[model samples]
Target: MKLSHALAALIIAWFAVFGRIQAVTLEVNQGNSTCIKAELTASFSITYNTSNSTRTVQVPLPDSATVDAGSSSCGLDGNTPWLVAVFGPGHALGLSFSTNGSLYSVANLTLQYNLSDTSVFPEANSSDVVTVVSSSVGIWAPINTTYRCLSSATFGVGGVTVTFSNMRLEAYMPGNDLSPAESVCMADQASTTAPPTTTTSATTTVTPAPTPPGTPERGVYSVNNTNGTACLLAQMGLQLNVSYFSQSQNKTIQELVNVTPNLTSSSGSCEASSATLILTEGRATTLTFTFTLNSTSNKYHLSALTLLANWSDMTAPLSASNTSLNYLRSTKGRSYMCNTEQTLAVVPSFSLNTFKLQVQPFEVTTNQFATAEECQMDQDQMLIPIIVGAALAGLVLIVLIAYLIGRKRSHAGYQTI
Candidate 1:
């Protein structure tokens, strides 16, 4: 009887161990039945905040067996097309189909990433590689970076978020801290998703993303697309501003641009973005616009999208009688530079809803604002002369008082010199 009882206990223990082993196998690759390659989808894009370097990552389908369906707006990183810049594992990428549309889905995921693992990425352990994963980008600089991924990225903090995974992650350097255009590298094994462009035939009607409160519904946007690689010369004030709606986010943003750019006469900072432009003349320059659209008939309404730079100039203020238009005409050797490009109304009526600009805020080289510390320093600098003058006055007053006391003592003394 004792032997039979012992034998039965041993059998029960063996069964419990076997069951545990089966459960462990189910959790492999996040419970993926079969590992499948990742693909790029329209729902993928990258956006960076100039204010903060907090990157919100959503990529890499956990399971190749199950794929999600969705789309996102992705094109034009400022002037350069997104496909040309955002590529590979370093930048944020979007993946679509999984294992050629298998019956699997990434039910849940717990991404364990060391936010600040900045050891040179893609552990290419090929003897000459280093990676640095950084949590706080304040310290790490994504130097000599290249943007490459399988799919394109949208502009202006795009709204489309995909459920699947696989793609790249870009560097997050705040406010030109480290090469505004540079991209941060991603570590290997982390970038398990490859660049594969595959899509489903399902048609998705995407609704516009929410807009900020008080955003204008319509207007022509000015942007800085033409200031290719030109450092901003000076800053001027803009009295007039133009605006456009971003289809990705359905929000209106300010920008500067000309239907037909007269680069010679455009002064200050004439750069373009999808949504905003800076036609700053570093000095106050009154921008005037006039256009003659040759419609088949004479049914054309002429309007002007005049942009007046509103910022103060480092140099002398624009003349109260503003001779900027006259100056541009003389310098560019062109007549009618002041002929009023458009009438008082916008050149293209908002009703037409054509002619909009794009804004790759990350790619914007100009329109930069001074930091708090920098502004404080400027204040200190301006007060320096005043401080020196006050010190001199105090010294002179002390000297004067001393002289008066000395003269009084001499006058009172019996012996004089």
Candidate 2:
């Protein structure tokens, strides 16, 4: 028992030393006054190309990062104030702010990274350093109150994306304690421009897939086994619509937030009779899809679904799970396919849409989907086209018979005359 205790202590010490520590606050000074005081937490998703393939890496802002007071400056002449946090060689986090009336917002975020640095990118191959910039983060706060958002918000420029959450920021305030947040970030406050859709022909227009109420992007996700064989595959757009009581804002509200894919923050496990896909959308939301196979029936189905949402308004994150699901069933080797969009109300606080979805949980041979089992929605959609075609055929037959009878009557009338 003594030996075991000593070993446990050593393990604890090792973890303390190796575990990543997150910084709580950052202060930038200009001349004799504090320019900015931000308590921020963010994670970056960067897509970079290596010598052989393209990969995405997620890295959090480390605690060791420090403000660059020498290069940072306060706002002047209607220009925004900016702050820079330098972490390591050739890597930094930069932010610029915008002010309107009594509110202030983050206008731009610039991320500089070095691909050759193994400390930042574990799969570094080349020595190229690049900067990715995102604009209009939509975080706003009143001048008297610090801007705080517990919900995660995502924005991206090209291949670089940032998910900002749990932030408390005050700009141009000196020698004052941070006040409570009265106004938080909301999607309606941000500027959004929809892209124009292209068509194959003048008569053929393709409709884009529907995303969740507040989410913007969708993706296809896959989980592989140890031998590099795919064990589970899914394609869908997800969003979490939930209601919570905000203690700081003193109100109860509902938020519909998008669930974006974080490839670097996801994991999966596969067994002979079961498979699980665990996907994360940032630091705040997690989605778990569990599937099981039944050999006796030669079929597989989604057996359970779990969603965890961490909202700042609540004391603890809400966990919504449904284990009684028998949805998305298919043959053991076939995939469940549905082209129509659907909303799944798993629970009151847990609802999402699986848009343009196709999933195969087990027996994914050749890294491709086999024959598919059409979902109820797809089967129902197929009947609409068939019904329309049959109705048109019947209308044409009636028109032809009417014309023939009119001609026969005219001929009989002429011969009798």
Candidate 3:
């Protein structure tokens, strides 16, 4: 047959150029240049081997990448492979070498565009090679594996636009040969609001009153003299005892008495015996006889008894005298009869009466018989010779008995002398 069909077409073109030179090496161990407004993921992994028979692999991404080609199994001679992918946004997926009659074979490539500036691959200009090569592989086999591109674009340019409200996103991949894939965009932390505070208070008071209680708040007889006799004889008669005598309240009544009499015979010839008279009633009183008799003993003895004696109420009856003879003569013509027996209480009891009287012989060169026997012996010593002839002998016997009865009636009319 035409040389066995030319050795089976040279063993099927060397088994499709040795399965595209032993393909299955797609490594963008991480890639994403731009293309994440929201949903985004990009990863790469493929290490190949399928010469002894088992194979089925495919891994390509960047259409705003996304992939979970985990749990894969592909073997031709074990060198583990078949981790496949192809995901969203202006894409470029790499690592290809198909076996089912081969047609896809590209070692590695990763490109993700469209940070949406109206898409169609925009927003990548910071050095602008943000990777771009989609599906036109084959230039001196320069697509040979190994890649790592991580880019998150939210960059603003001329038309400035950046917005992410309350956003947070963090990613880190550790296995399946994407050794460096990290992303973080977190912002959402807010809380605030304050103002309001106040307080105050005050008070005062006083009172008092009530008090009262308190109250306590009487005591005059006098008499004095040593004595010069303020005469006070009180038997209630002497003007009622001198009206209660208070001569400056005197007090010295040691019994007062003062009497003095003396007449020792002035004319006597042979008769003159009448001496025994004593009277004392200085201040002791029951008065009845306190002698008085003075008008010359009533013209020498006509005796109308001018109180010759009274010893306070004696029995009243006296008149007895039998004359004989005597020298006790003080006469007008011999008259000396004395009687006072009102039961006499001593005027010497009338000299114990042994009456003998009649001896009137008187001449002494007559001065009218010597003034009538010295006025009848001073009226028989009444009140002791008139308190001893005081008051000038009773005013000279009352002017000589009124001029001797007016000269005996003018000498009895010049004839009956």
Clashes of 1: 80
Order of candidate numbers by TM-score, starting with the best: 2, 1, 3
The parts of candidate 3 lying over 4 Å away from their true place are 1-65, 68-89, 92-111, 114-167, 171-187, 190-417
Tens digit of lDDT per residue, candidate 1, span 367-398? 54221112223456668999999999999999
Cand. 2 TM to true fold:
0.48
Assess each prediction's global lDDT (C-alpha) against the native: 0.26, 0.69, 0.24
lDDT of 3: 0.24
Better of 2 and 3 by TM-score: 2
Error of 3 at 339 (Å): 99
For each of the candidates, give the backbone clash count.
80, 0, 25
Which whole-number lDDT from 0 to 100 does residue 17 have in model 3? 28
Off-target runs (Cα >4 Å) in candidate 1 are 1-60, 65-374, 414-417
In order of appearance, the predictions have TM-scores of 0.24, 0.48, 0.13
Q: Point to the candidate with the largest lDDT.
A: 2
Q: Report the candidate with higher lDDT, 1 versus 2.
A: 2
Lowest lDDT sum, 10 consecutive residues, model 1, at 21-30
Question: Residue 332's C-alpha lDDT in candidate 2?
Answer: 89
- Sliding window of 10 residues with minimal summed lDDT for model 3: 216-225
